[model samples]
Target: MSTTDYLTQGRRVLEIERAALATLEKNLDAQFSQACELMHYCQGRVVVTGMGKSGHIGGKIAATLASTGTPAFFVHPGEASHGDLGMITKQDVVLALSNSGETGEVVSIIPVLKRLNVPLIAMTGRPDSTLATLADVHVCVAVEEEACPLGLAPTASTTATLAMGDALAVSLLHARGFTADDFALSHPGGSLGKRLLLRVADIMHTGARIPMVPTGAITTDALLEMSRKGLGMTSIVDDNNKLLGIFTDGDLRRILDLRTDVHQTPIDQVMTAGCITATADMLAAEALQLMESRKINSLIVVDAQQQVIGAFNMHDILQSGVI
Candidate 1:
């Protein structure tokens, strides 16, 4: 096909799938609620099972459910009959996916699930099919047509199934009052997790590593501290260790025109007072925002008494992988 023909065909497929999702949304009723309620209250994992393309969607659904507060895992219907069925417990809920609602491998497990008294939640295109009839709750994911030209591929139907799965997962997430911190617990290795879970205290240089100079210290002393700490800035504090001001590379350049004596000038006299500061408990991502909004590269972490406790720069945030 020519480029235009290919583009047209791709658009047609997207349109069809989009329509399928709309239909799935409109058809949602009490059955969807029942399914969520069952999975939400499930004492054990939600065991997802299916065959072929449906199974692929089931795996993703299981993962989404697991990550979003609901404990769940996918079990291949074919393997379930052989021994994986043992993974399902009376305390667990079974979510079965089949477009026709009559996949043999999936249907074969209904009896075992029934015997174990496990709640069955079936997602299918046909409400009257065997799986739906036997399920404790039935969610119709019926699509008007497949996106494929031949209407033989599981295109729109699979998209509808996945969307329904997402809807259910998100609903459960809200019902459980799941928070970003809970999600970070499951995704700690990812960037989003780092952004949400990392605190300024975790990434900030603490103790002697912090670049700091006393209030009466000369500008030369501040410069020495900034160089030794390599943070491009130094926190100016009082005898009690309370923050007084800050001296940065920017201040040095600004004072150059006046030819101020770095050795004779008191650090507080040349330092930028009333500088923006952060708390150690503040989120690293929040600190990054403070830096960007203030157009500064470093932040001095202080305690409730405004005492200097730690310090961090943009490079520390970058190295922490919070960005």
Candidate 2:
């Protein structure tokens, strides 16, 4: 096909899928609410099962539900018949998916689910199908047409199914009062998890790790502390450890340009007074924003009494993998 034909075909597919999604939204009725209520009150995990393409979408839906505070996992319909069916208990809810609602492997397990007293939630394009009739709650994900030019591939139908699954997951998420911390608990290893859960206190240099110079110290003392701490900057504080100013490598370069004797000049003479500061309770991501917005490399952390308790630099956030 020509380039123009390819572009037209791609855009047409997207328009079909977008229209399908719009239809799904309009058709969302009480069934959607009932499905959410069932999953929300489920005493056990949501066991999602499907056949082929539906299976792929079901897996993603299960993962989303699991991460959003709903306990859920995907089980293959084929595997469920062999032994995974035993995984479902009376307390759990079974979410079955099939566009036509008549996949043999999925249909074969309906009776067993009934016997196990597990509630069944069916997502299907045809509400009159056998699976829909058998389900305790039927969520219609009907789409007008497939995005594929062949009209045979599961395109628009699958997109509608995924969108409906997301709606269900998010409803349950809000119903459970799920917080970012709760989400972070599920995604602790990812960069997104680090951004949401990491705090300044967790990654900031504290105690001996922090470099400090008293107000009366020479500029050379600040330079030594900066070199020893290797954070590119040092906090200048008072006798009570209240932050007074900061002397960075940038300050030294500027002072050197003026030909000031570092050994003779007091640290306060060259330090940037009333520098920006952060609290230990601040989020590392927020601190990163502050640093970026202010065009600074580091910040001094203070307590409620404004004493220098800790400090951090951009490198610390990078090393901690919060970015």
Candidate 3:
């Protein structure tokens, strides 16, 4: 076949699947709402079960539900008939998937699910099929035709089922009042979690690591502290260790323009007082925003008493991966 022919076939397949999704959306009814309510009120985890292609989609649905504030896990129907059936409980809600609603492994386990008094939710193309008839809630995933030219592949049908599963998961997520912070807790190792949960204190330099100079220190002494700390700036503090001002590379440039004697000039006379500062508890992402907005590179972290407790720069955010 020519390349054009292959492209044409692929496009036809996508068009078929897209239509299938549209049909699924139109067919949604009260059953979808009832399914969401069941999963939302479930005191136990959602036990997702299926066979073959449906099983693959069920696994993805289980993962989506788990990450979005719904506790859920997938189990193979064949295995459930063996010993995994013990995993189901009366308190749990069971989500079973079968395109034909007649999958042997899935059909055989409805009795066990019933015995356990578990609420069964079924996803099937045929509403009159055994699985659908036995389920407490039936979500119709019917498709007019398969994307395969031969009309034997499970392409469009599976896509519709997966989309329906996603709709259920997302509806439950909102109904449970899931927040970004709650999502961050479940995804602590990901970039979104770092941006949401990581605070300035977690990455900022503190105590001796924070380069600081006394208010009366000479400009030359402040430069020494900035150089030793490698932050390109030194915070100015009073006798009680309260923040007074900040001296940065920009300050040095202005001092040079004025031809001031670095060895004799006090830092307080040349420093920028009451400069931009951050709290230790502020998010590192917020610190990055403050720095970007002010066109500055560093910020002094202060406490309730306005004492310099920590210091951070853009490089710190980059190193900590909160950027």
lDDT per residue as tens, model 2, 86-199 = 889899999999999999999999999999889999999999999999999999999988988788999999999999999999999999999998999999899999999899
| Runs of candidate 1 exceeding 4 Å displacement | none
- Candidate 1: 10-residue stretch with minimal lDDT: 214-223
lDDT of prediction 3: 0.94
Report RMSD for candidate 1. 0.7
**What does candidate 1's lDDT look like per residue over 167-276, in tens digits?**
99999999999999999999998898999999999999999999999888988888889999999999998889999999999999998878999889998789999999
Candidate number that wins on TM-score, 1 or 2: 1
Candidate 3 residue 237 Cα shift, in angstroms, is: 2.0
Model 3 error, position 238 (Å): 2.5
Best by lDDT: 1
Instruction: Provide the overall lDDT of each model, using Cα atoms, as 2-decimal numbers.
Output: 0.94, 0.94, 0.94
Better candidate number, 1 or 3, judged by TM-score: 1
Local accuracy of candidate 3 as per-residue lDDT tens digits, 1-323: 89999999999999999999999999999999999999999999999989999999999999999999999999999999889999888999999999999999999999888888899999999999999999999999999999988988789999998999999989998999999889899999978899989999998999899999998899999999999998989999999899999999998998899999999999999999979999999999999999999999999999999998999888999988886
- Model 1, residue 89: distance off in Å is 0.6
Clashing pairs in 1: none
Best by TM-score: 1
